[model samples]
Target: MTELTGTSTGQPPTVDLGPYADALTHNPHPVYARLLEKSPIHRATQPDGTETWLILGHPEAKEALSNPSALSSDPANATPQWRARYLGDPNARELPQGKSMINADSPDHARLRKPVQRAFTPRRINALRGTVEEHADQLLQGLPSDAAFDVIDDFVAPLTLGMICTILAIPDLDRDRVRGWADRIGFPTSAEDVTAARHELIPYTDQLIADQRIHPGQGLLSELIEATDDGQMTPTELRATIFLLLNAGHETVISLLASTVFCLLSHPDQFAALRDSPTLADQAIDEALRFQPPAISAPPRFAREDCTIGSTTIPGDGSLVTVVLSSANRDPREFTHPHSFDITRPPGELLSFSHGVHFCLGWSLARLEAGIALPALLNRFPDLAPAAELSALKWRSGPIVRRLEHVPCKSGARSSAAPPHNN
Candidate 1:
């Protein structure tokens, strides 16, 4: 492990974060806390040997995320060296494959996001409460009564994927393929792998959009296609938009569901609290999000010009600055008892879903799914507990998202007598 050479009161150490990348994936709070205490902003070398700035303070992270003038989301704006080292062949471009709303800076971002924003409004998401409930119930009903099952594969993944597919009108037959592509995109081993996955997925989305053109449906994909017809967006933009929605919609929820369940199961007292007061489900989900956010950090934000965050000066020479959402959510200055997980931690703003114009478009939908699915799962299997030791569980190895390979657990069929509250 790379150790910080300086004390918290001294100059910030130039640490190589590459060595601690695995630790970040497994459990980042301790590492983040240590880094934050030493320096809220530190210059670190990534595993890939690329240098970047990591913002670990709550105030700085929020400012970096919401500051449009100082930072640009577009990779093309990055310094050639920074882009080539991190993204490979900085000049070779075809809009960089997965260039969607999340990556596009203003004007383009505003244009791309405006079309689909209506589909994710509070009113629209709330309408799907019934659908989310039915899917959660059905997934719980299918769990094997006599065998231990992986909560991620048998429950969370399917439930989240189903909800996203339903919202996007993805045909059932395409779901497995979509999931495979999404997995590769989220956790690619190499740049070539990501490019190849994007290559495969873009054409698939193109066909989906083409199909929607001929026969429109009530899903967001069909709605975006209609926008394309009105000249609001091009075919490429439409495909990219749909790709973003599908991956973002499902993957984040999968992490949220799995982590929320893992947290509850690991902390039985908290689980009992939730079961006793089902109304705490939403609060519990928020706490889980703060405790173990799906996306550990926002995508790297390139400095548009020389900008200062806190006491650190970030040069404008294409510096890639990443706001560590996981760190910010646990900042002691912001949240009381930052390390402890309290479902009733008092509702407050969290950086898990990000902030500013680039905030997650699917935030409402994700919250709704967690609120319904979590309570339902716990209530159905009142004695649900981890079959595997928490230390033994395999966690996904990626910088962007934190998730378990599988959450193996005993279904607790014998204790399904009745939950404390099954509302």
Candidate 2:
């Protein structure tokens, strides 16, 4: 383990993360590099004045994520003061939203993750390739020939949203509303906006769950509903699990698609490589995930007991710790030329979707979507390039997820010539 020194009090030095939050949003690599260089772990203050332990090194992050006993996923295990300080309203009585597998531990996590895990298996995702490809082509076909299109609005958002909705069997009429709720929740907005999105989404999800229970269909949601019927989960757990899948499923893909295009377009050589050898699509997607992960950090984990992460000790009193996945993916100790965006780089582990028990449930689906969507888009528009300069792009402002506000690209007339290979 890498030793990380702290203050005289044994607590890591306090750094205000607020000042760098905007910079972190726009392009976090530099800020992350600085933090990692100083120390892989730091006690940082969030914009809202909440204190948290931020882990930046690849090894330390893996340690924190894989150790569930010391670092509990249950927010309910956190101290009342910690909850009140960070989450607000500690006394608020509500159903266990935190009981979802993403936020659960041990027996609860296993029970919640088991029922629907089969739906996201490699076999199931492979079966959905046709549907994913069909949707990708449909979205690509709609692009205008004469002008620049916002990839976020025109392509990634709709493609990912539509795919998840189809998989979950969400009604078409309700998708727009669901998208609105997802947008408000996923991006950085006012606290009121977040609360409002949750308010709208919870009741909507409840109704969806109720409907699934009554009239089971052919999707993962229906499968989970059956699990609920069989005493595998509670109504609240069902609702929360569905909500997690929907929110995580679409949003992460949105970021992946946008970031993949942005990265590829910026590196024309790699883009050409992928375009030339379409077989490299899988590697390209992995590189994209490593280079610019959608989720910059994992959800907060609470320390269940006095635990030592590296050489630094975290008190057991429900202290919060967040693993910076973005940083870990770029750690030089783990990857060769970590800053370079090389699609052909040897495959390796990535903290982007996290590791251990809480590893992303929808990873196969995410990979499948990117594998299909990227090559199709490039194949259709060989001359596709960024409509605006990188400096002009606006990134979403949030600590957890990193994404551009829009990726405007000018798809010039389709190239009749064969795809060019890197010279």
Please write out the lDDT profile of model 1 over residues 210-286, one tens digit for every residue. 78778888788878888888998887888788888777778899899888987777666788888788888888899
- Scored against the true structure, residue 396 in model 1 reaches a CA lDDT of 81
CA lDDT of each candidate? Answer: 0.82, 0.81
True-structure lDDT of candidate 2: 0.81
Model 1 off-target regions past 4 Å?
Answer: 1-13, 85-87, 93-95, 413-423
Whole-model lDDT, model 1: 0.82
Compute the lDDT of residue 211 as modeled in candidate 2: 83
TM-score of 2: 0.92
